[model samples]
Target: MSVVVSFKVRREVKELMDKYRDRVNWAEELRRFVEEKIRQLRAEENLAEILEELRKAGWSVPKGFSVKSVREDRDSR
Candidate 1:
């Protein structure tokens, strides 16, 4: 089922969305992106153990830096 929803976008966002119009979808696109990322991370070496080590060391990640986002950027190139 398809439903319509509305939200406000700033001028720059509208420009970028138009620039990438072919890649834009409101619903399942984000879900797909997240799912693919999870799959890729699951193949990494000792990912869970590394996260536990970070937690134990108390070396907090910088504000607004997501591990998934970093992985996606690295994989994109």
Candidate 2:
């Protein structure tokens, strides 16, 4: 399912776009840009939620915990 989406650009911008109309797929380009932007925003929102959950749980790691864990894994390999 698809719907019509429209927006106004500056006259200069519209003129520039028109100039390259033959070389560019403007609708696809705008759709991809909007899709990417939505993905980026969703990722940020998900991260914020995860961080809030972590904060509520008061989770913390000891200093050097990551380094020590990595060293142990390498030694076992």
Judge candidate 1 against the unseen true structure and give its global Cα lDDT, from 0 to 1.
Answer: 0.78
lDDT of 1 by residue, 1-77 (tens): 85555668999988888788778774567568767998888867478888888999997968767977888999999
Residue 73 in candidate 1, Cα distance off native in Å? 35
Clash total of candidate 1? 0
What are the Cα lDDT values of the candidates? 0.78, 0.98
Error of 1 at 64 (Å): 46
Q: Locate the minimum summed-lDDT window of 10 residues in model 2.
A: 54-63
Q: Write the per-residue lDDT of candidate 2 for residues 1-77, one digit (tens) a residue.
A: 99999999999999999999999999999999999999999999999999999989999888999999999999999
Candidate 2 Cα misplacement greater than 4 A, ranges: 63-77
lDDT, model 2, position 7: 100
Assess candidate 1 and give its TM-score to the true structure: 0.31
Best by lDDT: 2
lDDT of 2: 0.98
